[model samples]
Target chain A: MKSLHAQHHPLADTGYQLTVLTQAEVEGAHQPLFATRLREAGLLPLRPTGITVMQVNVGKMCNQTCRHCHVDAGPDRTEIMTRATMQQCLDALRQTPIEVVDLTGGAPEMNPDFRWFVEQISALGREVIVRCNLTIIVANPKYYDLPEFFARHRVRVVSSLPHFSAVRTDAQRGEGVFGRSIKALRMLNEAGYGVEGTGLSLDLVYNPSGAFLPGNQAALEREFKQRLVREHGVVFNSLLTITNLPISRFLEYLLDSGNYESYLDKLVQAYNPVAAANVMCRSTLSIGWDGQLYDCDFNQQLDLLVDGRAPQHIRDFDLAALNERSIVVNQHCYGCTAGAGSSCGGATT
Target chain B: MEKATYYNPADLAKFGNITEWQPEMGRKFFDYYGEVFKDGALTEREKSLIALAVAHAVQCPYCIDAYTTDSLQKGADEAQMMEAVHVAAAIKGGAALVHSVQMMNKAKELSM
Candidate 1:
């Protein structure tokens, strides 16, 4: 399947998605504004706690075009980060006490400089997290050594596995993805990535296959552990439950299914203040492939840059001004702040 | 204005508003309902499945909708949820069929 960008779908445009999200009413009923909810929670104009993690989107190039992908990434995507931009990121990291540098992409490995970037980040003595889609490791013979390479650098491997069942997983992802993911997990297990004491972390991410929100994170983790062990003999450290933000391809889905209004209402009704207070945007800065900065990955996808008061690009790297500037938020922010809250690492509350 | 129906989907969201009319009993019932679904001998996930099965048996649209979401939220997969409903179906069907012995006896007596 082609990405929204590749298909020339209207929802692929970030501006259109934002307009739909920000509108106060859907189907003539009041749709709660995310900012007003934040205001009620005493968190309007949400500001950063501090910058501890820099999540860099190395590129939009990816292998699989999952239905709920907010990035709208696929094989056809050609937007990739240059070596110069990566160097700027490394230089920015050098100037700060940032401990974690998260690498994400259509598949970060798809980027030609991926290995070099990982080496550079590791050499800086900072934690590296690769948001790997597990199938990428087993996609081709060239990528087979990914588990060992990740092990060598002590990189935390986080991959999305929507469900353990092939039918459900493949329904959202692609055909034969579950089998490839299982094969990849076994390879990681052999490398001691998710073993008891290996320090090499291999975490699986679970997002609901439908429009509904995910279950309790800890309970989902327990069920995943039991089923993977008993059924497929696969094991992971923890399951990170991420909510599907209504954007890009997912926005297209909501609209096409006539579920846009109801899904937004579900999110608005499920909004939790504690989750709002602990949103990942409070501490993480999202750097786009071209070095443009965003409040978070979702905001990055929407082309919502950081507050203008702060440096707009990674090359500038003003920690103080960035920390002082308020985060740019829209209705899609509801996804992150709904229920227990979702982040790259997992649940906030 | 919108036309009113026998079962308005919008009314489900207003379920909590029952307390506005009769605060004391409503709050107590809700408190008991919440406590009943917590993890005990049966996990919350298990209770959700049971609630879903019961929701189907009772044929409550509000409950079916609520428990379906609740069951999924508590980590019950689609297969497990469907099986729960089938259990409800079997029981409901069996209850009506179990009186076959009485019908057979009445038929035999009338014939004699």
Candidate 2:
């Protein structure tokens, strides 16, 4: 609380080194950690209680540079998941009880072997989800066949469109992104996603266009449903209204826009015990592009790698070990527990 | 260290000092107050907008400062939040206006 104007400065230039200062703030803040807040509400630090979702960052290589991209992904980003790392993730999946393999990245599909990876994940009988940036679908010719490919594998697609309005979507993501996203959504619809009985689920993600948290999940879903169907003839199974976590690009936005202190205060003030109890960290395992592990994707983004005793990397994954280690937490975690709470899949509460 | 003004923006952060003066009751109140805002029958956003409206009527700079941020954090747009304040203003004004019937009744009784 000692004038965190210093700590709240964007780490745009510093990269992962911000992790150290983040930890210090978590330790020294007058407010308690979200973990401690949870404990006070009777939810104590337990092991990776139950890992149902294994989120693997395939790489940071992305086609578009969204303002709030937590992955720091962009076209120039060279880091990518190699075949070996992908195989290791597959190996970990085979050995563990994880039934959902969530693939994320600058653009998960941008990887050369992305198709091979999805096919393999499906072969393991795991539910595969791609955290797609919709623009990727229409970004290039190589991606043109994605709709057909996704349908064949029955891959669950979760893409961020931000809003039903093109101006809003394009404003946050980039110019021309809204057009590409609508085209991509229609293509996914053509492939049977969000259709009545096809079982190929196509979920859309909606994070706020700015520093604020997202509105109510169910209501926003309805509005998005009506607008998309009415205006674009697009359909989707469900919509996830996510609270933007203060990390990476979003943290930069808050700092740059002078909302950093107030935003953090707002997150702390709106802490919901119920949402904190059901946080995604309690049930998910996050894997970095390099196979390093984390409690969640936000933690992965910070490179706050999982605890010391836990299997630090997918290659060394031991369920029992991970199950016993306490989750790593910091101030940024307030984002996940604020209001209805947010996770990769959406609000927990 | 009481200031002449009853409320100061800086005092919002130091609101925690209330506990130092009265630990037992202060701790109890803070705990109960936090529980009131959890996602329940009404969402946190709904609660925030309501809080914003109340802040206006109560005229507590601290509550107003807190709830304005809370309203935004809960994704209430500037326009919607301003509307909430307007709702508060109308309600506050109506409460006073409605009470004026008593003044009219007193005048009628005096004349009779």
Residue-wise lDDT of candidate 2 within A260-283, one digit each (tens)? 776777788879988877888888
Error of 2 at A157 (Å): 0.6
Computed on C-alphas against the true complex, the DockQ of each candidate is 0.61, 0.24
Steric collisions counted per model: 0, 0
- lDDT of each residue in B1-112, candidate 2, tens digit only: 7667766677888988899989999999999889998878987777889999999999988999889767755555566788999999999999999989999999999995
Residue clash pairs of candidate 2: none
Off by over 4 Å in 1: A25-29, B1-4, B108-112
Q: Which candidate gets the maximum DockQ versus the true structure?
A: 1
Relative to the real complex, the DockQ score for model 2 comes to 0.24
TM-score of the candidate numbered 2?
0.76
State the displacement of the C-alpha of residue A245, model 1, in Å, after optimal TM-score superposition. 0.9
What 10-residue stretch in candidate 2 chain A is worst by lDDT?
A: A1-10
